[model samples]
Target: EPQGKIDTGAEYEAPRNEIEQKLVQIWEDVLDIDNIGINDDFFSLGGDSIKSIQVISRAKAKGYYFEVKDIFNNSNIKALSKCIKKNALTISQDEVVGEVELTPIQKWFFERNFEEKQHWNQSVMLFSKDGFEKEAFEKAFEAIIIHHDALRMVYKNENGEIHQINRGTSEKLYDLNVYEGLSEKEITEKCDEIQGSINLEEGPLVKLSLFKTHKGDHLLIAIHHLVIDGVSWRILFEDLSKAYEMAKDGEDIILQDKTTSFKEWAVEQKKYADSYNMRKQLEYWSYIDKFDVRKLPKDKEVAVARIKDLRSVGFNLTKEETEKLLKHVNKAYNTEIEDVLLTALGLTISKWTGEKNILVNLESHGREEIVKNVDITRTIGWFTSQYPIVLSSSNEELGMMIKNTKDSLRRIPNKGIGYGIIKYLSKDKMEFKLKPEICFNYLGQF
Candidate 1:
């Protein structure tokens, strides 16, 4: 197979008639496919580990011992069939297996009061090379809602407490409340206008618009940051591109990669948050007064600017300029992208305040240890956590400062307490001097 091609779609040799027929029936049932070809790859057809387990458990109930890895290695039905030789599985077909384990994260916050209607807001403009393709794009839009369950997830109360319910994406998506007949420019303006106010729901919130050009070329996707944090976007975008490509190629979509869920992460966070280490970590930020700083230089900015036109700004470096700088950052300090970016950000804030008594809030993806193969870039989850680090600079020994960061970060307790403590202390209403706060939150690009 040439890079993802299912070439050997018919290369299986069934050892026993009864076992072979049973395997084929089980595969068809789990995969929801009609045809029974031995060489057909399960993964290529959208089967995943979770689904593999389901098949394995079912086979085990019928007295078969097909390991999960065995399924993965022998993805094609033919290969799996040959591997299952000399083993005629008995089928009881009564007991069920491979049930989803309720994640630890889900257990903790299950008692919290979760909102029902619109947890967060979002908007997006759909652009296309073909202007008349707006309708087609809307059809394409439905596919996204169908693919990701996190998008359809809503808050539900099982017993007096609340929890996230994964309303599996089947079809009510076609009924998505889409406001049609919008010009490309008008759509762009609408999205840019609303981007600032979009607090976005707890999970992955979505918005879409059609930006058809005179000649025709546009972008089409908008989602809230609450659930789909920094890393999830990359995963979402990649899945979107591939799914769309496969659809265009007329292939069946069998998206099967959600081994972990957001609820599990949330439950785990609560667990770790309640630990002894967490309590000590909390001490570091209790009444630390992180925002005590000098004023800004420009002095002309909103805590958040609510403008009609949303413009994009970024600092771009040339290859030579970037390489030379990277060489210094790499050879001198063995620095990371985040360390470099944060150090620069600290320096900017320091220069603006004209004070070295700098206390700035830093952020890192807290989902690193929460789940296995989470692909933080795809599934919707509150995976971002804040870390407040003080980068003191009385003198301009910048190199020394960068070199010592690895140790500074390591010496701190696990992030669970550092952030949890800050949130708890900051919640003190007595410290509140303003209604609509002046807390500094610079939500940046992933």
Candidate 2:
């Protein structure tokens, strides 16, 4: 046991109604906050996707369940309580433990070395002008490593197949390398140098370092993509805030129990892949595979060597313009932005290459309703699904093209996650087919 403990006593207005009371209890337990107001925003109070799952999981245990989207859309306790009342759901088992199979995304990653120059390690550097306790941050990080299973994961090749092995509880925390009085340029160069040096086999695929400067300490957190994604970052940061607060006061680091272990999700996914429902989904993809659409043409042909290195260019629209455009388009065509974007792309490519039809790879969140009663709102891993879509602009009219794209996207089974099932998981001997040239994924607003 640690020598010192932090006091978590605080005061706030009490819950007024049954729904608010129950929600308050749940938030207090999950967020480790002593007193929570009904009007408090979830994200403002450090609630994240993973914790959101915990909220849903706990609410179901109390005979109320709501959609994860509801939580995202209605974040405050008052709004969430109303949502629960309007949409009460029966409790279902949402957790699984023990060794798990590799998900399709993981299999795809391991099949080939996606990283040619550096390991698939991502890092974020944060600097604060006000100083903070280094020891407290270290303890907070230690708690996070124990709370999240993926952080302590390692891979093993068993009989020519790779499997993710969760270490359960880890007693070790990542050592934060500290540098004092370093120049900003030197610190950046040092961070870049360290970013390329992660060893996947050695395990504990996350690294952190702190650089002390006149302003404060610059913290850099690096993690491998195999076990984490964009949503996971939100959860990790939220937990870190709570943990840091606790550790600063020498309090015991406590986090809400994890809902579903990643291993359990993988096993459930594999079972779903082999089920009759998945076979039906494959039929949908089979129909799509019959079309041999033209690929998007490039300005110039590049050497094979240059294919490994890719560059990106981006443009942005004002918030008002973007929201209005989406609203007008959806209202006019009864479609989402994805349909409008894909239709525009198809039209642009058709005009550029003089091709009536084209093929593009589309990526999705992959958290489709494949398995029953399993909520992964809090579960984190790379749940990205990649599939090919055939787009045609034979009519040459923008409205017709939009309708064609909307109808085509609507026809996809399971939002295209089924594509991976047919191509990768199906036991039937599969044929080698050409893949889409241009990949397009609309990542929801940052």
Query: What is the lDDT of every predicted structure here?
Result: 0.49, 0.71
- Compared with the true structure, the alpha-carbon lDDT of candidate 2 equals 0.71
Q: What TM-score, over all chains together, does every model reach?
A: 0.56, 0.77
Assess the local accuracy of residue 105 in candidate 1 as a C-alpha lDDT between 0 and 100.
30
Clashes of 1: 24
- Per-residue alpha-carbon lDDT of model 1 for 321-434, expressed as tens digits? 654443334434644344555566667666766777555555554544322332222345445555556655555577776666544555555533346333432233123111
Q: Give the RMSD in angstroms, all C-alphas superposed, for model 1.
A: 13.1
Pairs with backbone N, CA or C atoms under 3 Å apart (clashes), candidate 2? 6-250, 6-251
Span of ten consecutive residues with least summed lDDT in model 2? 1-10
For candidate 2, what's the RMSD?
A: 9.0
**Model 2 clashing-pair count:** 2
Best by TM-score: 2
User: Per-residue lDDT for 303-340 in model 2, tens only?
Assistant: 46353477778898896776455434455665666788
